[model samples]
Target: MRKNSFAIGCACFLVFALLRYPQAMLEAGAKSVTLWFQQVLPSLFPFMVACGLLLRMGAAEIVGEWLKPLMRPIFGLPGIAAFPFFLGIFSGYPMGAKITASLYEERKITLSQAEHILSFCNNPGPLFLVGTVGAAFFHAPFWGYIFLFCCFLGAIATGMLFRLFYFSKSVNDFIPYQKTPSPSITECLPQTIADSIDTITQIGGYIILFGVAVEAMKQTGIFHFLGNILSFLPFSEEFLCAMSGGILEMTNGTFLLSTAPDNLSFRLTAACMLVAFGGLSILCQTLGVLRNVPIKKSRYIAAKICNSLCSGMIFFAMAPFVEKYAQKTVPTIAFLAETAFTIPIFYIKSSIFFFACAFLFALYQRR
Candidate 1:
């Protein structure tokens, strides 16, 4: 039943893409597809390989130890669950799901812990936000930090909420954690790279398909129609478009909002909300990962709702300040402020990157 449902969803998405962006599909033929494949693989492959090495080396154990205290208080997750929690937050949605699967397979963490972590663990890093969404798309670095904060806060809130209301008594009936055998760095590196590449290759089709659908939606005036419908509301067209896009592709959706005709305040608000929701693209990826896991969609949806509301409230509160200050401040000053704010979040972001690297390092060192 679940498989059939997923297949139907994919078919619907494909049909929607074809109908809306016939030209985009045509343009995205072999050559374009190949180029995208090439571009994404090189970077993604090595990262995945590193991730494998890290897992093999017990790098997660090391980071989990360091993060245990902080995470315990914040989310009430067990120490070992921290690895997947951080993985989800930093590495992106399904990555966290992947880590949870690994832990489950290894009998490291219980199913209950995995479910709890899933409530808040699946977020992308700040770099993806500032570099891809903010700098590349929005052309405003400060907005990226704001968006990150909103998402972070939302995730934390959801985690706490789950702990309060949905605390599960059933522990994971898995194997006890034992020291994992390690491998050589040279062996680990190649393997990690290979694994990462394989993962990207597995998902690359969905990414491109999504891109095509978005382009089709734009060309077919679906966004315009959405804007028209949203016009009846008090918010600007940009906010509505962003809300729609964020649900589709969080980063791209927010990017569109940044380019909307409305004021910066509205754009900032929408961007934050989109990020908080983890966007639809991330949600789909999350669903893919949780397919084999025993996660409930209701929990995920509740988390998103909480995220949207919290993020919206935060942005609205800051709207006047953003509007007043953003225009008056020089780009240089704003950039400096962004840099200052990014520095701290970057540390939090690095937890995932560092964990990935350290995992590989441990494997190789042991080898």
Candidate 2:
């Protein structure tokens, strides 16, 4: 029965792909496919290699230990879960999902903890916000970092809330920490680079496919059409667009938010919320990672709702101050403030960037 269901699902996907974008599929012959493969390889190669080094060096274990006390109180999760939890916050979205999946496979965490972690685990990494969204998209590093801070606060609040309500159980359920002996820097660095490359390469195809799909959707005016309809609703236009982009592809969605026309306050608020939520694209990947785990979608959905509510409230409360104080200040001052907020987060392993790197490393090292 499961085999038949899987076959049907694949068939449906192929049919949908063919029907929706026949031209792209047809023109996406050998050359286009090869080109896509080549384009994504370099970026993924370094990432994979880096992942390997982190694992071999036992960086993940070190970070996880560092994060145990903080995570235990806030999310009712064990020390081991911190690796993925932090990874999600620093690396963003699917990276967290990937790490969570790995932990589950390794029997390092229980299903309940996995589900709870997934709720607040999805986050946009600092690099994405500061480099891509801030520098490239918004052209304002200060505002970008401020928004990232807001999102982080929101994620923490949401995780705490979930811990208070649904996960009131004792921490005994958490797996006992097992220390992995670290390799020497000399040996570890080369291995890390190689592993990062391998993991990145395997996941590279998905990233490119997702990126192309987003581009194709943009070219087809899907976002515009949806934005037009959503604009009529109560929320801000930027919010609607951000939500749409998030549902399709998190990176593209964030990119779109950076380009949206509006006040910095409003744009920052919406972007923060989107980043906190980790977008629908990330959710899809999370589901894939959790497939073998005994996780429930309902619980995950509830956690997301909690996260959204917390993030939304934070964004609203911060908007006024950001506009009045931060906006009038020089960009340098603003950048410094934002950086101050982000610095502590960078060291904290629970952020999305760490999660992506750790998960990639874990996946690469899995026997």
Candidate 3:
């Protein structure tokens, strides 16, 4: 009861402060809202919907069966682990945590397995990395792919570590395992789309809220103060600033890193490390999804650190090669002409075309 009261008191104080600075609050809130509607939502929504439909439609069993041979040997996990592993790589961020929780809640995975999965699965989505961060911010689409590749490598390294310690399962151990039956596409379409939208909206809310909080910190110069403290160490000012922002929120931190006055390798390394760490916001989302399941917080944090370190090392190793080629991959004018003029129309048309194709295929399959 005392703790609850103290928490409430703290919350009230924060609210009061924000109200007192209505201008700052409004500006911060607007920026957060714009990032959601304009950037995050468009990039992640399609993948979220696709992942939801895939998972519910029994794509897990299919994937699990196919990947079982390699997954068991390499990851020390049952083939069922493939679902969240792959989705986390592609769908990004909290999706891995969310899927892991679903697997646990439905008794598809054990507590230990779920814990190991969290160590590696929660990652930045490829679309955001490649499209938004790479193309829009860095002006190098290759950087996005580089980040994605390093993330996958880092995740695999983390998995190998876990396989040696926590997971003792071998290829022969899971032969008896079975998967859930998926519904026909027509049968699951409505729920798939609905659940995807709901999850995306919740994710959007968290992103926006965290964005505002980061903005508030910036407005108050807290990040600079934090950077000053870090300057005592060997880290650079740019990295310190990036870390200060990334520590709270993933997207905000990555965005900040892009603008940091550092070499491409330094900035890219920092961004990849932060993505692997996944910031506190990502962890909160992960734990919230896993609230019902038994999880060891200390172990989880340690795993994330290990994963981050692994990602950082891999990023540095290939970064020189990446930088050498990324800048010259395409001419500026041609790239601009395509991105500015040709892509939007093609993207919209392709999206519509695919949806129509899926609709027709579903109808035929249903009959």
Q: Pick the candidate with the highest TM-score.
A: 3
Clashes of each: 13, 23, 0
Which digits, one per residue and each the tens of the lDDT, describe model 1 over residues 28-93? 545336644654555445555556677778887777665555555556665667677666666554
Instruction: Estimate the TM-score of every prediction.
Output: 0.75, 0.68, 0.80
Model 2 vs truth, CA RMSD: 8.3
Candidate 3 residues lying further than 4 Å off, grouped into runs, are: 1-13, 168-175, 179-182, 185-187, 328-367
Ranking by TM-score: 3, 1, 2
**Best by the lDDT measure:** 3
- Candidate 1 differs from the real structure by a C-alpha RMSD in angstroms, to one decimal, of 6.9
Model 2, C-alpha of 117: deviation from truth (Å): 2.4
**What is candidate 2's CA lDDT for residue 253?**
70
- Ten residues in sequence with the least summed lDDT for candidate 3: 333-342
Model 1 worst lDDT run, 10 consecutive residues: 327-336
* Candidate 3 clashing pairs, residues 3+ apart or interchain: none
lDDT of 2 by residue, 213-240 (tens): 5555555666677888977776566657
